[model samples]
Target: MFSMDDFYKSGEVEEDGWNLMSSGGRSNHGWRSQSSVCWVGATALCLGLLLLTVIMVAHNTSAINQWDSKYTDLIHVLTKGRDELRDERDQLKIQSSNLTQELEALRSQYNDVVDSRDKLQEDIKNLHRNRTDKSCKPGWLKFNNKCYFVSPCGTSKTWEGARKDCQQKGADLVIITTRDEMDFVKSSFAITWIGLSRHEHEDKWKWVDGTFLDGDGFWQDGEPNNSDGEEDCVELSRSATAWNDVHCNQKFSWVCED
Candidate 1:
C-alpha cells in the first residue's frame, strides 16, 4: 500500500524539464494528470500479468492430460500383448505334452510287435529242431542209428512167414553183424529167427544177404546137428550166446531191424 508521494520523496530527485511555476500549477502538459495516469498503468499491468498466468496454467494442464491418456493407452497395449504371449505359450506347452504322449504310445506298440516277432521266430526254430534231430518212431528201440521193433505179443510165425512179413513191411530180420547187435538181439528175444539160411546149398550156411556164415563160434555146443538134414533156419536161442539151426517151418517170433 505504498503511496506515489512516498515513492517519489524517498529519493527526492526531479527532472529538469518540469518547472515549478510561481502560481503553483503543474507545467508538464500531457492529457491526463500524473496520479490518474499512474493508477491506470498499474491496473493494466496487474490485469495483463493475471491473464498470462491463467494461460500458462491452462496450457500446462492440457499437456499433462494428453500425456496421461497416451500413457494409459500404452499400458493397455503392453498388457494385452503380454496376455496374448502367455496364452500362446500355454498352448505350445499343451501341444508338446500331447506329442510326447503320442510318441510314447508308438514306442510301446513298436516294442510289442518286436517281441511278438521274436517269440514266433523262436517257436519256428524249435519246430525245425524237432524235425531235424535224430529220433525213432513210436514203440521202436533206437540203436546205432537204426530202429528195432520187437513183436509186441511174442506171437510165433514160421521162418518163411516172418521173413515175408519183414519184407512186406519194408524191414528185414535182425542180422547179427556186430557183437553189440548180436548181444542186444539175443538178450531181447527168447527165441527169434534171424536173417540166416542155407536153403540153396547143403552144409554151406549163409545169411539172407548172401554172406557166408563162417564158423566163428556163433553157435551152441551141440547146435547145427542138422538133424534129418532139414534144419536150415538160424535163430537166436535162449542161451544168449549163440544161434541154433532149426527147421525152416518152426514157428517163432522174430525181430525186425531198419
Candidate 2:
C-alpha cells in the first residue's frame, strides 16, 4: 500500500531539509519498522532453541557411553572372580585327593609295622620258652616249657576262688590252646575249671591271664546253650577234647599253670 508519494508528500520539502510525510504514511512506516525488528528477534530465538537442544543431546549421549563403560568393567570383574573361584575349587579337590592317598599309604605302613611287631613277639616268646624248658618244680609237671598243677580231687572251688588260689601259688588258671594241650589236660584232670570265661554281656571268651581264645574253643557240642543264661565259665570234660560252659559260681577242681 505504500508509494513514493508518501515519503515526498505533495512533492514538498520541509525547511530543516527533512522529508514531509502525511500522518497516514508516517504511521505505516513505523508499523513496518516494528514488524522487521520483531521478525529478526523471533528468528534469533528459534536458532538459540535449536542450538540448546543439540547441546542437551550431546550431553546425554556422553553420559550413556560412560554408564555403558562402567557396566562392561563390572561384568569383566565378575567374570574374573568366577574364574578365580573355579580355580580355587579345583585346587581344593586336588588337595583332598592327595590327602586321601597319603592316608592310604599311612594305613599300609601301619599294617606292615603290626606284622613286624607280631613276629618280634613270637621270637621273644620262643626265646623265653627255651630258657625255661627244664625249670619245673617238684609238684608241677612240665609241658611245652610251662609248669602245670592239678588241684587234688574234692578240692573244688568257685571259678573266682580257684583263680585266687592259683594266684597265691604264683600261677593262674590253665589256658588250653592247642588240641594236644586239651588232650593232656583232659586226660590228667577231668571235669576241671580252665581259664576261659567272658563278661556277662560279652560273647567272646578270654582267659584269666587277659588273653582271648584263638579259633573255635573245645566247646562240647550244644553244651554252652548258656543254660539258664548263667553259665560263663569254661570247664574241661572227661571226654576226649570236649569242654563245657558252667556257671562261674559253681565249685570244681581247677588246673593251674605258670
Candidate 3:
C-alpha cells in the first residue's frame, strides 16, 4: 500500500546505509548473484542427467526382452528335436523286436528241415546196404539182419513129413521168432507148412524141433484155434500174412529151411 516514490526513497536510503558498511560492498553483492545463477545451472544439469539415465534403463530393458525371446526360441527348437529323436528311437526298438522274433522262427524251421534230411539219408543208406549184401541170398527173406528160406515143396504132409523134408535140405520148417520174421515168411507168396502142431494134447501147440512154442511168433489175432477140435497143424496162407491150422494130410506147399 506504500506509494512508489516513497518506496524508491526508502530503497535509496537503505542502499546508502549498505554502502557505508565495509562487509556489504559491491563485489560481495555481485558474488551473491553469480552463486545463485550457478545453483540454477547445476539444478538444470542434474535434471538432464536424470532424464538420460531413465532413457538408458528403458533401452536396456528392451534389449533384455529381446534376448529372452531368443532364448525361448532356442529352447523350443531343442525340445522339438528331442521329441523327434525319441520317436525314432522307439521305432528302432520295435523293428529290432520284430527281427528277433522272425529270427527265432526261422531257426526252428531250419532245425526241423535238417532233422528230416538226416533221417531220409539214413533210410537211403540202409536200403543200399541191404541191396548189396550177399549173405542174404536171393529169393530168401531177410529180417533183423538174418536170412530165412521158405521151401517151395508143394505137399500136404504130416508134421513128421514136413520136418524130414526140411532136414534133408539142410534147413527146417520156418521157426518164426518175431513179427519181422513172420512177415518175411508170409511174403514168400507160397502156402507152406510150418512147425506148429498139436500132437498129443488139445489146445496146445508144439514145434517140429521138439521145443515148446515158448516166446515164438504167433499170427496176428492168434491162430491154430483148432476150431471144432479137428484141425491140428498150422500152415502159412499164400494170400496174406496169416496162419491157419488145417488137416495134416491136406495137400499144400511145404516150407523148408536153410
Candidate 4:
C-alpha cells in the first residue's frame, strides 16, 4: 500500500546503527586503559615488598654472625682457663708428694738420733751401775773404787806398825796416784803414815807393795830434804802435797786401804 514511505524509514534506522557502533568503540578503549593502570600498580607493590624482605634478611644475618663470634670467643677463654687450672692442680699434687717424702726422711733421721741418744744413755747408766756395785768395808771411806781407813783419834802407830796392822786385814797403806786421792788423804788425815819409805837407799823412796817411787812422792815444798839421815820413813804432811820425811820410830795416825 505505502511502500515508498516505509523504505525511506528503514534507510534512517541504518544511519543510527553507525552512531551506536562509534559509541561502543570509545567505551571499550576506556575499560582497557583502566585495567592496564591497575596491573602496573600491583607489580610495583610486589617489587617493594621483595626489596624490604632482602634488607631485613641481610641485617639479621650480620647480627647472627656477630653473636656466633662472641660465643666462640667465650668458649675459647673458658677452655684456656680450665687448662691453666688443671696445670696448677697437677703442680700442687707433685708438691704434696715431695713434702710427704721429705717428712718421712726427717722422721727417719729423728728416729736414728733418738736411737743414738738412748744407746749413749744406756752405756752411761751401765758404767755408773758398775761403779756403784762396789762396796767399802766397815769403817772405811770409798773413793774411785778404793777404800781408805783413817785411824780414830787417840790411836797412833809407827809407819811399820801401821803397815803391819793394815796387812793383818786384806788392805795396805794407801798409795796415792792422783791429786784427787792425795787431796782426799790430806783432808782425812792431817799428818799420817803413808806407804813411802827409803829402805833401798837413803834418799830413794819405795812403796810398801814393793813398787819403787818412780816420781817424787807427794811431798811438801822443799820437804823430804833429809833433815837428818835418820828420816828414812815418810809420813803424810798437813800440806796438800801430803808427804814429809820422818824418823822411822815416829808415831802418827796412819791410813789403811781395802
Candidate 5:
C-alpha cells in the first residue's frame, strides 16, 4: 500500500516499475483528455437535439391551433348555411300555401263565371226565338216564337167539346211548344185543357192535332196514369203546374183561337 505522496516524492525506484508508471500515467492522461473531449461533444449534441425538439414542438403547436381555428370557422359557416336554407324552405312553403289558396279561389270564381255565361247564353237564345217569328201575335201569349190563344169561353163545355170548339175557330187545341209558353200559359190560366189526351190507352198520350206527345211538357209521373179508364183528356190544374187526366166529357173552360 504505497501512499500517494510517498509515490510522487520517492527518489529510489525499481527500473521496470518506473517505466510501467510512466507509461500508465501517459495513457491515463491521454484517456482523460479524450474523455473530456467526448463529454463536451456529447453535451453539445444533446443541447442541439433539445433546441430542435423545442422548435418542432412550437411549429406543431402553431399548426394545430391554426387547424383548430379553421375547423371552427368551417363549422360555423356550415351551420349558418343550414339555418339559411331552412329559413328559405319555410318561406317557400308559406308562399306555396298562399298560392294554393289563391288558386282555389280563382277556380271558384271561374266556375261562377262559367255558370253565368251559360245562363246568359240561354237568355239570349230565348230572346232571339221570341224576336224572329211572326206567327205569334205581337201582344198575345208568345211561346217559342209562336202565339197561343187561350180559350175565352168560360167554363161551359167538356174538354173534348172545348178543343173542337177551338179547332172551329181556325186554331187546333192549345199545343205547348216551349217551356216559356207552357210556363206563361200555366201562369195565366188557372185550369185549362191542353192539347194532350189519353183516349186510346191508359199511359199513351197524343196531342189534339193527332201528333204523339214527345216533348217534356207532359205531366210528371207519366201521362194519364189515372185509376179509372175514363180519363182521356189532360187539363192543367190551377193548384199545381202539372197535367191531370180527366174524363173527356168533363165540363171545363174552353179555349178559343184568334
Candidate 6:
C-alpha cells in the first residue's frame, strides 16, 4: 500500500502496478465500470418487463379457456333440452292421434246401438199391435186385436162422408192389411168402401193412416184401370173377384175399425 503522494512522485512504474499518476487513465476505468453497471440494470429491467408480459398472457389464456369450456357445456345442455322437448311433442301428437281413433270407434259403436234400439222398438210395437184382447165396444165385432162396425143398410155415403162419420164414432175406415183381413171383410160384407184410397195425382194407393199398400193388393182382374181417370176410391165389388176402384164421390156403405 503506497501513499498517493509516493505514487505521484514515481515517474515510471512496473507493468503489474497501477498508474495512479495519470488522471486520464483512472477516469477512463471509472467510466467503463459505470457503463457496465448501467448495462446490467437495463438488461434486468428488460427481463422483468418480458416476464410480466408472459404472466399476463398466461392469465388471459387461462380465462379464455375457462370461458370456452363453459360455452361448450351450455351448448350441450341447450341441445339436450331441445331434443327432450321434441320427443315430448312427438309423444303428445301420438297420444292425440290415438284418442281421435278411439273417439271415432266409440261414435261408430254408439250409432250401431242406436240403430239396434230403434229396430227393437219397431219390433215391439208390431208385436203389441198383433196381440189379441177383449177390449171391444158394443155392436162391434172382435177380430184378433181389433173391433169393426158395419154401416146399416141404406146408410150409404160418399167415401169422404164415410170417413168423417167413422172419425166421429172414435173409429176409422177398415184397413185390410193382411190376406186374412181382406178375406174376412169380403165374406162379411156384400159390397162396401174400404179404408184404402188415393188421389188422382198419385200413382199408388195409400191407406187412411198414410201408409201405402204393400203388394198389388186384392184388385179385381183388370180393375183399377182408372177407366174414367176419376176412380180413386177402393171398394169390395158385389160380383167381382176381390176389390175394385170406384169414384170417391159415389155413395156406398162402409166398415169402420175401432
Q: Which is the leading candidate under TM-score?
A: 6
Give me the overall lDDT of model 3. Answer: 0.75
Candidate 5 residues 142-179, lDDT tens each? 55555566655454578768777777766766776665
Clash count list over all predictions: 0, 0, 2, 0, 3, 0
Which model is ahead, 2 or 6, in terms of TM-score?
6
Q: TM-score for each prediction? A: 0.46, 0.50, 0.40, 0.48, 0.42, 0.53
| Cα lDDT of model 6 by residue, 1-258, tens digit | 899877766634543345453666889999999999999999999999999999999999999999999999999999999999999999999999999999999999999999999999999887776555346788887776789888887789999999999999999999987868776676655788899898767888999989999988888899878898889999986566388988999998889988
Q: How much is 36 displaced in model 5, in angstroms?
A: 99
Ranking by TM-score: 6, 2, 4, 1, 5, 3
Q: Per-residue lDDT tens digits of candidate 4, residues 1-258?
A: 769678788777777787788789988999999999999999999899888889999989999999999999999999999999999999999999999999999999999999999999999999889778878878889888878888888889988888898998888988878888878887866788888888735557888888888776577788877777778888877655567888988898889877
Error of 3 at 43 (Å): 99
lDDT of 2 by residue, 180-253 (tens): 88777877656888998988899888988888888777778896788788889988988646888889998988
Candidate 3 lDDT over 56-105, as tens digits, reads: 99999999999999999999999999999999999999999999999999
Candidates' lDDT values, in order? 0.81, 0.86, 0.75, 0.85, 0.76, 0.86
- The parts of candidate 4 lying over 4 Å away from their true place are 1-132, 200-203
| Clash pairs for candidate 1 | none
* C-alpha-based local distance difference test score of model 5: 0.76
Displacement of residue 65 (Cα, Å) in model 6 is 10
How far residue 148's Cα lies from its native spot in candidate 5, in Å, is 1.9
Against the true structure, candidate 3 reaches a TM-score of 0.40
